[model samples]
Target: MMNINEHLLRTFEARPGEFLSGEELSATLQVSRTAIWKHIERLRQEGYEFEAVSRKGYRLVAKPDKLDVEAVLGRLHTRVLGRSIHYMNEVDSTNNVARELVQQGAQEGTLVVAEQQLAGRGRLGRKWHSPKGKGLWMTLILKPRIPLHFTPQLTLLVAVALCRSLRQITSLPIGIKWPNDLLIDGKKISGILLESSAEEENLNYVVAGVGIGVNLLPDDYPDDELRAKATSLAIEAGHTMDRSEILVAFLQELESLYDIYHEQGFGPIKLLWEALSVSLNRPVTCQTPKGLAEGTSLGIDESGALIVKLQDGTVTKWYSGDIQFSS
Candidate 1:
């Protein structure tokens, strides 16, 4: 069945900046003019701006700065990733929901998104700040057939995808801080967390949790610690941007990158990740499960491990850890 709202949107999108007459839309959608008017009002409440004429029709003046499932889907053009979407007003965490869905046999490309995450978490169990209608809190479920040990490389792939998408949408000097936290002008603007369930050497499922500070204001991070380290696109761009558009762009980029990784391997992904890394050749201290390894960052190795040249001229590889840099 044709969706009434999507049908109406397609008409406006097909013309873009031109008006779609009420009579034409009614006939095409097989609905009454009154029903069309109600749908327009519903979209208006969701942040879309429509210019209605007495006898002419309605025009899509602007889209809202919020994340709407239909809005994101309309802009998405991906073979995989974001084929199915689960949107919520609030949740404990999109990652948690994605995990549950995967257990219930959710397929790859399934997505879970929430406007706010009450128990949002980051790497090393850090609490992510997710207030209502402020940021992008979502997770992607992937059922990659790659070896279980290579799953961490997906984090780098996600970072590269996000970097490409953000670069196209805004003019901010975004850089990938080693691993997958995105930084704009030295402050963290986004982060990626990876979780997977696997057997000894085989693969199962992977969940890539992504939290982005989009259209957020200074007051959004009330905590002094977060206020000093975090920033939003709206705060840096001097204005708010449409979160839905950015989400669609990200999914498209991710889909492309994921295809590349599966077919061409991690060589291409590592090159792009290294080119955009801010930690290379910089002094750093990584706190791994073993202990602290302080050294100069030598970039990542083929297996996606951080190569650090310690002070004693010994080089060590870190697969999982928290990276701390010196000023």
Candidate 2:
């Protein structure tokens, strides 16, 4: 299993240029020859390039193109957020993997990151575009002691943190679009999806999944219509971006803001979120299950609900709705 992979990885790192014979590896690892062979096969399947000669044995050649974990860990300044990272080159979804870890007793601040997602998703079951080596797809597991009703505030807090991080790293003007979308030049660049599990009166765990379209080229977008509505950091900056640096910066920002929210309350974070919010004080139309409500955006409530002030001067609080700007 993973133990064997770790052992092989350590051995390969220690003596990369030298070849270790099958018998020598079996004896050193204290495993059967069949086991060592199987582990090597698995490593090959996992994208670790290896050269095997008949009598000379196996030699590690190259590593898979992936996110630089060392670079990310080196720049990471938080005590949490990425203390323990589960990195994958490819996965179904980081959120799904993080949820599975939470069910198996993963600690708070545990992060699951993937370079590519085969089945990534956004809110309301919408498909999220995730091209390999082009974006950041990560999920963080959190176990807060707060009430279940207060969980939604974390979504807004993350939005503010992402906005700050993006500002620090790039010159692009990034803005928060309502609940959890991040926009650059009035086009979508990133989104956040928050899923939670709760007990009767307490919160069990929450998984906050963040997807940033970082290094995607303009031509990589699937459709022309969608391309007009979507954008990436590379497109806006006119250059390729370092995913490791951005990911580390984002984790640090999230950890700092999360500490503030846990110690004080959502009041302070809400103020920051509102300041970066682009939808407030603008004419907007919200699509609700009931019907469409057209009004000017007021602000978010104490519980993070979107507040809309209708033309009739009646203010309504919306818990879940699709928001659109009105010209």
Candidate 3:
């Protein structure tokens, strides 16, 4: 059963540029003519433009390129993930809002998407570049049944999903660098920040913060220093991308891979992650709380640890770290 907004939007989409009278819309939606007008006004607030005549009801004059929840919802094919979505024009951080939603009893697969983030972040407290309408800034809430220690595997799994989706949508050579930084042509394009809460023993929930540089130009970077190390979908694809398309594809892939992870375990996901990793066999250094360890990357274990052969002829698995590659 589709909601009224969805039904109304679909009707307008099916008959693009055609005018439907108030009586027609009211009959089709089984609502009063005034109700239709209210819905149209709400959509206008969401950045949809409409043309109204004396007799003709309304016509969609133009659709804003801003984030459209209905656009994403119409194309979403996932079972659990992204079933409920909240869209914002700008947020301090999607993760912050998502954590609040979780505390307010937001269900699993609930998503918070923003067109821009004021305080966007990456792993290790790094500031993520998210300009207005130039990136996908979102936080997905999850309550996976997996144990606390193995929760890190979700980061790798999401990387695989994102890699497959971006490749399918934009045909970009996206690969995962270590835990969850997405790269193309050896420059960063996306990053994932995972935050979770736990009870005395069991895990409570996880908030996966994802930022994808969609249509950012070279000027969106905070400084020349970051511009040399990061790229965007528009830059790599040579044109502006339909951010909603990428969003739907990402959610679908994530849900599919997430299901596989819960049913079959991390072995299969680890293989897919390794296949898309760019850090394997590279000279890398991991900065843990203990200290920094430099080694050759040997890929990740089932527990999502980076297996490394240290500089002193010893092997170590780092569960958490800031990874940097040696050029």
Candidate 4:
């Protein structure tokens, strides 16, 4: 059964630029006129603009610039991704919360989201700036029945889904760096961090932490260093976008691609990812835990490791590293 708010939204969407009278809504929703009025008032408080006349009732003129569980679910059309949501006004990290929930037997497609992350972190323990309600700071808990080694491919899968989703919203040239850093105009715009646990050969759960800078401006950065390296969707598009719509599109694309990954394999996803890659066939160096290796990137192998052909006619695969490009 649909909720009253969702019903109201559908009614407004079904008949755009047309007034819905109180008697009509009351009869259609099987509720009192007072109930309809209350729901409309709540939507208005959430930044919905309504044109209310004496007897002409309400008409939706605008929507909120926010992304919450309700907003995402309102527009979501997916099978697995984003089926369950844990929304927070503020939290330390969505990934931490997602891991905790998965340990408690949370189902796949469970999403942990926050308006602000006090302890948000990217790969290599780098701090990720998550201001209040300025970006999509969320983590998805997935339980793919694959080996621990194959789990790295999910990061690449997420990069492809993210790139496709962002392309749907803006005309910016979005590309992926090795391992899954989303870049636009050669500047970082998003990052994906995957954490997982396994017992022997059996696989456990994987928490995918995703952070996308949406509505932030260059001045929002704390210092010039970050401003020079980071850019947001709003900064590139010259307008603020609806985070809810973007999240819904991302979930839909992710679900479709994830199903394809399970049925067919990683070949298709790898092709798509490589097509959007920026580091492939480029001169780069990986700073690993042992040391640094400089070579020309040969894209990725089957297991999603960074493949680099060194100058001395040797090839190496880097599982985890800080990649630096030396054009």
Candidate 5:
């Protein structure tokens, strides 16, 4: 069956705020008038509010005040990141939706974005605050042919891209907090989560989900303790930001970096990531599931693992761990 919602969305965008006659819609869609009515009802049920005038027709009054697909796709300048966008007004999670689509054979570079997530998550399975119309919750699917071991490079690539993009767009002193978190003045501002599907010798795809605390007010965070540890770009910048613009910039940066990684490998990107890394040359304590270790952060290896120089002048490589700076 044809996707009625898709058809309605396209029609609404083509003739926004203009009356679209039911008969004309039926004729154009080649469906029965009953089907057109049913689709209209479904769209209304899905939060699309329209004005039906007597004998005039249906005029799209207001769409859900969420991330408009037209607005986001219009601002996108990349050929891939937003070529296939699945925008949701309210979803459980963009990563969850992206995973389901990947299972259904969705192509690489497909993006799933949600204005609000009921159960958004971060690394280590922590709950991410995703209030409505406040933050950017998005997931991008990538099917790189690279080996499974090289997947960590993707996280590093995203971190660098986000830091650079934020620096260019906002007047915040954004810095990377080791592995994947973006921080401004020692508080969390954004995070990146990379989940991949791979077999022993081959790789299927990678879902890189990024959640940015953009335009969220301090009061938006319900928990007092959590609010103290988290901050948003809007709060830091003291004004509301166009989340669509930030999304487009981040996607463009990701695409550019991905192209570079695919063509030249992680060598050049690693250099850039290290240059922007705030952990390097700083005193830090690495907390792993095994134990706690203290060291002076040296840099990252070619595999994207962190290099820590211990007090004994011995350098150790860490694959994965929660890093805490010791001032």
Candidate 6:
């Protein structure tokens, strides 16, 4: 069966800045005029604005500022990432949805994106601020053949991609915090979370959840603590940004990095990651399951572990935990 809504959207997309009559759309869609009208209504409910005339048909005048499925899909030049997408206006979490889809045999490179997340979560299961149409929230599924223990590497890889995207689109100073937090001048701008579904000793699939503050304003972060540390591209750039552009940019960079990772190895990716890292060569505090330690980040290793030089001149490799810069 044809997806009447998606096809209808494509028709308008092809003829941008133009209007079509009901008869023309009906003839093109091979459906009744009523069906075309219904489809247009559906698009409107999805944040699309149509200018309907008395005799002439509808024209797409405006689109949502967030990541529209058709818009993102059309703009992507990637081969593996973002080929398949499941879009929702609002959801509990894209990661949760992607996991369910994975169980139902969703292929690798499948993406689940939303305009808003009702119960979004960040690292340590903390609440993630995902305002409607104010940021980008999505989860991408991958089924790499790497070991399950190496899944953490994907997080850093994504951070590199995201940081590259921001750098390309804006002039603000952008860098990656250890692991996968993206910061613009020491303020948080983005986060990445990786969840994998694996068998006893093998990996089945990995869900890389990404959340970015694209066009968020100061009003969005009313919390005093959040306002001090959290920021958006718009806030830092002093202008509004299109979330769709950032969405496509991130996907393209991620696809390229993923290819490099598969074709060569993690060495190249580690180097790229180190180049964009803000924690390296700086005083840092690490909190691991074992205990807390202060050190200077030397960079990551081939296996994606943090190499830190402790205060006592002792060197150690941290395999797991979170690290925060002292300064």
Report the number of the highest-TM-score candidate.
Answer: 2
Residue pairs with clashing backbones, model 5: none
Per-residue lDDT of model 6, residues 1-327, tens digit only = 659988988899999988899999999999999989888988888788999987877899998775567787888899988898898889999999999999999999999989899998899878999988988899999998887777778888888989998899897899988888898778999999899878876889999999998888888875989989999999889999877788889899999999888788788888889998888899999887768999888988866788999999999998867787787
Candidate 2 structure quality by residue, lDDT tens digits, 77-165: 88878988999888898999999998888999999999889999998889888887789999999887789999889889989999999
Q: Which ten residues in a row have the lowest lDDT in candidate 5?
A: 63-72
Return the TM-score for candidate 6, rounded to 2 decimals: 0.81
- Which residue runs does candidate 5 get wrong by more than 4 Å? 1-65
Number of residue pairs clashing in candidate 2, backbone atoms closer than 3 angstroms, sequence gap of 3 or more or interchain: 0
Candidate 1's clash total is 0
Model 1 root-mean-square deviation: 6.1
| Error in Å for residue 15 of model 4 | 23
Off by over 4 Å in 2: 1-65
Q: What is the lDDT of candidate 4?
A: 0.90
Show model 1 residue runs off by greater than 4 Å: 1-65, 289-291
Tens digits of per-residue lDDT, candidate 1, 1-327, equal: 658887788888888898888898889888999999999998887667999997888999997545778978877888889989999878999999999999999999999999889999999888998987888999999998799888888999999999989989997889998889999878999999999999899889999999999977887786888888999999999998888888999999999989999999999999999998887898999877767778998989877889999989999888777787875
**Which lDDT values do the candidates have, in the order given?**
0.89, 0.89, 0.90, 0.90, 0.87, 0.88
Model 4 lDDT tens row, 1-327: 999988999999999999999999999999999999999998887668999998688889997555667878878888888989988878999999999898889999999989889999999899999987789999999999888888889999999999999987887999999989999978999999999899987679899999999999888888999999999999999999888888898999999999999999999999999999998998998877767779999989888998889979799888887788997
TM-scores, all models, native as reference = 0.80, 0.82, 0.81, 0.80, 0.81, 0.81
lDDT tens digits by residue: candidate 5, 47-132 = 78888987777888877546667887887889777789998888898889999999999999999998899999888888888888
Evaluated at residue 128, the lDDT of candidate 5 is 84
Candidate 4 residue 19 C-alpha distance from true site, Å: 25
Better of 2 and 6 by TM-score: 2
User: What lDDT does model 2 reach?
Assistant: 0.89
